[model samples]
Target: KIFEGNGAIAVKLFPSNVNVTTTLALASGKIPWVEIYADPLLNRNVHEIEVESEASKICIKVENLPHPDNPKTSYLAGLSVIQLLKQLSGGTNIVVGT
Candidate 1:
């Protein structure tokens, strides 16, 4: 996909695998160039992100394990949602780093 300017473009290519890119774009206000690779030989899903600017560069890599009950959902993904819900409900009353 050729992007003329800046925007998230993963929806058309990989709709089911776009949480990371979408969250990053919304939080950072910078559209990230996204690339998805399918590896049947691997047991987990992998995401690698690299951001470069004139003064700084950031690299992030995440390997998410598949949920035992549901292969379509990642274990970490569900856990994160639960954590977010707990935080929003004020059940923990603890400040956690995002």
Candidate 2:
């Protein structure tokens, strides 16, 4: 079955999939308009975000391969979390992007 809706509905129906939206809302201080789609045919997890303002417009899209041992989560996502932990622990002084 395929599911589609706004962020609130996505949260209710698919809590595990709303991490990006939650992070965006926290970082931007605004709840973003969101569209969620559940497609069984897709072999990879895909996320797309677009933001526009008076000064600039930003668009980002990421397609992540599923982890070999854990099909429910992406391999890249796991690596990202590890990297974040490392950064938070002061393992690196370099910071990229805002």
Candidate 3:
């Protein structure tokens, strides 16, 4: 969805050395309202989580760790969903086997 909306994909320090301030590096004023960007100084891999809403001019960013084995995959991709469902099912940390 993001790629389709932006019509461009900016990738850096991906599957390689992650250093310095990384970003989407999109064209000037490319994004209509808000654009998602990520540059983790410590995390070698990351996912630039961003949301856009023209109706309210809302842009949300939520970065997450990449797959333990592969930096390309998002760690929260599946774990987050599982965690949310667990929490909704009366699950708790340490006590309920979160």
Candidate 4:
């Protein structure tokens, strides 16, 4: 059951070193979930994700990589600025997912 199940996932978790909390939260990764923290060498540009469904909760982390086009910024940097401006300008939320 460990190697084969109806549900399977592959995640590359870095050196949060590890976590006891997620072990309990996702127990056996059965309900479909995992957690991780970034350990990208000495990088500090942190990124986080939180996912939850009726069955389980998962959290992930990564040290954000800077956009090659802009070392001081991540790709989302442009999108974020646009989003904020949209918000301030009263733009609407375009529905993305169901």
lDDT of 3 by residue, 1-98 (tens): 22222223222212232211133323334433223345546473433434445655543445566778766656765586678878787776434355
Total clashing pairs in model 4 = 0
Better model by lDDT, 1 or 3?
A: 1
Candidate 4, residue 31: the lDDT equals 44
Off by over 4 Å in 2: 1-6, 85-98
Q: Which stretches of candidate 1 lie over 4 Å from their true place?
A: 1-7, 92-98
Error of 3 at 75 (Å): 0.4
Q: Which candidate would rank higher by TM-score, 1 or 3?
A: 1
Residue pairs of candidate 3 with colliding backbone atoms: none
Clashing pairs in 2: none
Which regions in candidate 4 have their CA more than 4 angstroms from the true location?
1-58, 92-98
Question: Model 2 lDDT vs. the true structure?
Answer: 0.82
Cα misplacement distance, residue 96 of candidate 4 (Å): 28
Model 4 weakest lDDT span, ten residues long? 1-10
Between candidates 3 and 4, the lDDT winner: 4
- Per residue, candidate 1 scores C-alpha lDDT tens digits across 8-75 of 56656666777887888888987777766667888998878788889999888889999999998899
Estimate candidate 4's RMSD in Å: 13.0
Lowest summed lDDT window (length 10), candidate 2: 1-10
Ranked by TM-score, the better of candidates 3 and 4 is 3
Clashes of each: 0, 0, 0, 0
**Candidate that beats the other on TM-score, 1 or 4, i.e. the better one:** 1
